[model samples]
Target: MDSGLGEGSSGYSTMDDYESLISTTDAELLKRAWRNEKAAPQILRYEAALVQRSREQIKLMEETVEEFTSSGVDPLTVSLYQMDLDRTLFLLRSYLRVRLQKIEKYMFHIRKTTELWNHLSRAEQNFAERCIEDMEQHMQQSVLSKLPSSYKSHLKQSSSSEEDDMVPEPKLDTYVICRSKKFLGAFQLDDRQFLSIQCHLLSWRMNSFIFLMSMNFWTVLKTLLTLKLMIYTLYLISL
Candidate 1:
């Protein structure tokens, strides 16, 4: 059972480092399990391997504690090792238990059809059926018996209302006019209004230009009158 738990340098003296290693291994296994449901047997084998490893680790920790006691090591160091060992055992057991729980929950779906049941070995089929039976019994005794009548009724009412609620059709106002007769009429109206605005602007600009030209004409006339008066005055002075 190559659990894929890495046998790296066993020189990690701290609980944190050991936890990191275990967490990494557990994450990889979980990823694999999630990726393929058919790999349940492999997952179970890996879990068993981890359990074995945990047992070995606990034994080793015990021996280490014994050695430290005889060798005058600090009591705190021994207690730390014991704590780490206990934590490791707890995590390993929890990991295995969770996997088993998932297996039990999904056992029915895993072997729902005869074809699927036939594909499994006798032992696998038996194990799956056993899990199903156990789960069914547990649910009947613990979950179904504990459910309140009001909660069940509410659930039924909610489901019935959800089924009854038909999606309403969109209102006419929500529709956009793209290429209908109404759209063409609206576009023509808008075009006419835009043309009217343009005509008004052009008319105003032309009036302004005419007013400026008239002002220039008046200025030129006034200058010519002054020049003519100067010429007449010079003529009078010569006479």
Candidate 2:
């Protein structure tokens, strides 16, 4: 199987070099970003630079397609370019939509957690803030207004509650498939256990193991979803 790495390349290079070799196109980078976003249970750091470049490229492609149409380019050729543009647009939109869904599901948890809050882009932060406001208002008017003051706080179950136990959090203890370009032998999982990353395959079974995501695994990172995750990702794709 061709890994898309250069032909006859051997020995490990630096992570930067490896990533550069594989992600030679904006479309490839965007595809990887979309996969990583959809696979992870939690919201990831926004791919601001990649998003910007994709948008710019999409705009240029749109203009090029328009030019081709006006200049009487072959119908088949113009349609191909249009199809490529549509795919990129779909990826960008799908990536943003996934983040929105995660935000809506875990807005309270993400807002209170500084680390997660920092992962959102400014536009996403604004959207989350508005979502929180709307949710609080809806709850206040529809139900919380009739409840006792002790139970009115949305973040907590009751006045006596010591923490925001009502807030939903991401399930970190889930499996996600990660692929690595480099051949790794006996990759250590812990002091007592080890795993292999050969043939570009890995089944990482927790967000806690994300620390092992270094440069080699960074190249062409994509996920193979479990059954539950497959359904979830399919739902996102359908949107």
Best of the candidates, lDDT: 2
| Tens digits of per-residue lDDT for model 2, 20-99 | 57666878777867877887677878989999999998999999999999999999999999999999999999999999
Runs of candidate 2 exceeding 4 Å displacement: 1-22, 190-239
Model 2 lDDT, residue 88, Cα: 99
TM-score per prediction, in order, is 0.32, 0.73
Please state the error at residue 86 of candidate 1 in Å.
Answer: 1.9
lDDT (Cα atoms) of all candidates against the true structure: 0.40, 0.68
Error of 2 at 19 (Å): 8.8
Given candidate 2, what's the lDDT at residue 24?
64
> What are the clashing pairs of model 2?
none
Worst 10 residues of 1 by lDDT: 230-239
Q: What's the true lDDT of residue 144 in model 1?
A: 57
